[model samples]
Target: MLDIFLMGLLMAQYTYTGYDASAHVAEETKNASTAAPKGIVMSVVISIIGGWILLYSITAAIQDGSEAGLTTLNATATGLPPAQVFLDALNNPTMAKFLLFIVCGAQFFCGMASVTANSRMSYAFSRDDAIPGSKHWKKVNPRTGTPTNSIWLCIVLSSILTVPALFNETAYLAVTSVAVIGLYIAYVAPVLLRRLKGDKFKPGPWHLGRWSAVIGWIAVVWVIFICILFVLPPTLPITISTFNYSPIAVLAVLVLSIVLWYARGKKHFMQHLDKEQLATDEKKLLDEIDD
Candidate 1:
């Protein structure tokens, strides 16, 4: 029961993911310091309200309280529980298909936003020479001011990552767990750093003021808790087929990152840009804008 509760909590967190896209696009936003934080907050707030309503609607639509209804939902012809609920509730195949179509459209937009955020992140890292082949990835399209190379890199890498799911269903779960765990870790790192820094940590325009420490600690702790839960097997008496591989995936990434950092990145990667270089880049961007 506890494991089921934890899994539900983890799924809720996954639904709340991707709000950080606001922060990733800050460089292109107006009054970014204020706007970006507000965007992130509002996005989460809206998602929470909207997601709750959607869930409530779905639950209310479950017309059957009998074991037969459960069996039908579980063995849905479309292989989707939600679609079965819609079909059973409405008794209309066309309506269920329409609802599923709407869901697919929403998922497409969500994926697009993720891709955009990932590409921007890669571009920023490449600009700092933090990644291999930085020279190629850091290039921006002159006409669109977009990171075409980084965008393509993100697309290709994401496509390759999904290939494992084609062969094994368990691999799909592991991939999702790894992705969520990785995202939450990235989200909480700065908050944890800020808490550790205490008085030395500079507060940004969107800071929580007197409540910053409390909220930051809560965020960090929650992330750590979920990360642990994510690596645990979802089912008991787990066999090879049901094993959770998120820990293995995460460890492999950590090892690879450490090796790369020690071998090359530590020497070449600039953690912070020089003030003169920043100014030069700003001026160059202004010149390009003017032209």
Candidate 2:
């Protein structure tokens, strides 16, 4: 059960995936410093409550393990299967179909929202010249105020990434595993860097205040732990079919990124704003005034 436990963790993360949606739309949001952070927290809180409730109901519906007997012909379930659980719980195919439709719709919306968020993030990063071919991806449509190129790029990349899922049954798990690991690293890196900066770090309007260091360290540590846990083989006696490709995918991306950084990014990539530079300039101005 390490595999089972890690899968549960993955489910928990997937349940809370859209917390950054507000951040993506912060430019259009009013009082973003206050609102954006609130959005993130509420999203997580709601997801936890809702996910727990759903899990409870599903467990409750599995009243008799004997009634949901295992099928020797099937490869998926050695014991009671989820499809049997749903059917037995609902006691009606019509109700099950309706529930399935609702779930499908929700998944569709979630996918759309993710695309929106990723595209916006790509556009913002590109605008700061952090991404390759930033000039093209950074362009915002004058009429729509949207990054069309970045949006299309996100779509294309998502499609390319999911292509393996069409051929391999376990490919979707690997894709999601890679996404979760990469995202957690992205989330933790800034937090760890902020922790290293210590008291000299400036706080935004919405910060942890006195708890910043504690919370930052906790966040960084937890993310690193989970990232390692998820990258391990999802099942024992790893075969080509059961093997997790997430670590490979992540390593490939890192290698490609390092190569690109040395070849072109080192010279071309630029950060639009440097808080350290701003602080230094302010100090210089004060010294000039005193002199």
Candidate 3:
């Protein structure tokens, strides 16, 4: 029962993965400090409400209650249980296909949004010279005012990463796990840092106030718990093919990040700008405005 609950929780976390898109695009947004946080909160709230309705409707649509029905849905021709449910519940293949098309369209837009967020983040990192080949990736297109180079880099890398799914079926699950775990860790790192800062941490334009510590700690714990769940084997008697590779992938990334940080980032990465640097930046902005 606990295992089932954990698996459901893991899937929920996966579904909730991309809510931080608001933060990624903050640089280009007006009144970003306030709007970005509101965007994040609203995105999660909307997802929860919409997801609950969708899940309830799908659950209600499942006509079969037996183990055989489960087997049928699992082995459906569409390879999607929801599509099978729609077909079975509606008794109309055309309607099911149309519904599936709508779902696919939504997913296409979701992928585009993910790419946009990733490119912006990559551009930001490159702008600080934190990534290799920063000079190229940091380039913004004059006409579009977008990071064209970083966008293509993200697209190419995403395509390359998906190639493994063609040969290895389990690769898709492992990749999704890596994405969820990687994203959540990135999301929580700053919260963890702020918690470490304790009373020294100043409140932002929007904050949790007195409930901040409690809510922040709960979030930290939940992220850690889900991250652990994502890396665990999904089935019994795990063999090479059945093994969860997410942990290995995540460890490799951590090792690579540590190596890179020590090699170059430690010296070059500025965690905070000094007063002189801030003044220079302010002056630069003022000069640009004047021009």
The residue ranges of model 2 lying beyond 4 angstroms of the native Cα positions read: 1-3, 66-83, 271-291
- Residue-by-residue lDDT tens digits, candidate 1, 1-291: 577778888678889899999989999999777788899989999999999999899988898857897777888778789988888888988988999999999999999999999999999999999999999999999999999999999999999999999899899988889899999989998888878887875555665688878888899888999999999998979999999999999999999999999998998897567889889987775554444
Worst 10 residues of 1 by lDDT: 282-291
Look at candidate 2 and give me any clashing residue pairs. none
> Candidate 1: where are CA atoms >4 Å away?
66-68, 271-291
Ranking by lDDT: 1, 3, 2
Decoy 2 TM-score against native:
0.85
lDDT tens readout by residue for model 3, 1-291: 688778778677888878899999988898676788889889999999998998899889999968898888889888889999999999999999999999999899989999999999999988887888888999999999999999999999999988898788789888888989999999999999999999996665766688989989999999998888889998889999889999999999999999998998776665456779979997775554444
Selected candidate, larger lDDT, 2 vs 3: 3
Task: Tell me each candidate's RMSD, in Å, in order.
Answer: 4.1, 4.9, 3.7
Residue 256 error, candidate 2, Å: 1.4
lDDT of 2 by residue, 1-291 (tens): 456776679867756677888988898898776788889878888888988898888777764645334332132342325555677778887886777778789889988999999999999878778778899999988989889999999999999999998888679889988888887887778789989998787665676688878888899888888888887777779999898888998999999999988887776665455889768877875554344
Pairs clashing within candidate 1: none
lDDT (0 to 1) per candidate: 0.89, 0.79, 0.88
TM-score order, best first, reads 3, 1, 2
